[model samples]
Target: MADVAESERRILVAVDEGEESMHALSWCLKNVVSQNSKDTLILLYAKPPRAVYTALDGTGRREDPSGYLFSSDILAAMEKYGAEVAVCVIEKAKKMCKDLQQDVKVEVRVENGDPRDVICQMAEQLGADVLVMGSHGYGLIKRAFLGSVSNHCAQNVKCPVLIVKKPKTNAFNK
Candidate 1:
């Protein structure tokens, strides 16, 4: 019994506003989570770093390349929106966990930083047994430009990273 109790795994699932992450969460609940065992599910949402308008870049540019300077009011609204998004995503994930497996324990962590760094740090700090996240499935050019978060975490994290790619639904099905 002690060995069985100690064998329980801590699954860290990265979720966001995207449907891909939600699909990954659903898949983890169905496939990775066990019904008989008391596994802990950690839902992680990485809020992107807040915009900084105080300092100019090394090139002495106050405005971003978009040529739009964000006012204090706009920045505040953006922060508020980010918080709202985190809450909504966490609530949806929790509901899914409860609906699918009521016995399992679910935890949530919302950190501020780049998703790549935040996810990796949380996996190590929390001692996650496995890290599961969705893959945006960006093509070669887009991936090169955007940089894949899953790939970065898979390479950097100590624990095994499961990058779940949400399958594309046929247009006819819709």
Candidate 2:
């Protein structure tokens, strides 16, 4: 028991609006976190960077593929929406942590940047013992185009990374 108290681990879990991430968090809480020991669960959310749009014709007007101009107000609204999503994700994660284990310590961190970079940076900065996150399970083509955040963090971060894949539910069961 004394050694258990001394061996507290800081587990960092990356969360987002996706159900996959929430599932990872829930799994970590139930399996990795120690109830009798002093363990810290850090929940991290990376709000995407503000969108940067360039005009197709380079006339200083941001235009879509269809040539529809995007106004500054639209950009601002998008940013606001991202912030709101980050807040919601963090709150939901916190609630889940509390519901599962009332004794464990839980910390929340919200950062702005690409999740791949932000999660790695936070894990290093916080000196996490282990990093846990969810895999989106993208196929080869989609992963090639969008890049896998979990895969990038696993390769770059110094700490151990756990990528939890949510089991696919049958449509008929639902």
Best by TM-score: 1
Per residue, candidate 2 scores C-alpha lDDT tens digits across 1-174 of 667666989999999999999999999988888777688999999998876775432454445345446677877899889888888899999999889988889899999998889999999999999999999899999999999999999999999999999998898979
lDDT of each: 0.90, 0.89
Residue-wise lDDT of candidate 1 within 1-174, one digit each (tens)? 566555779999999999899999999989988776778999999999986664332445545344445567877899999999999999999999999989989899999999999999999999999999999989999999999999999999999999899998898979
Indicate which candidate wins on lDDT.
1
Give the distance in Å from residue 35's predicted Cα in candidate 1 to where it truly belongs. 0.3
- Alpha-carbon TM-score of each model against the true structure: 0.87, 0.86
How many collisions between residues are there in candidate 2?
0
Clash counts per candidate, in order, are 0, 0
Error of 2 at 48 (Å): 0.7
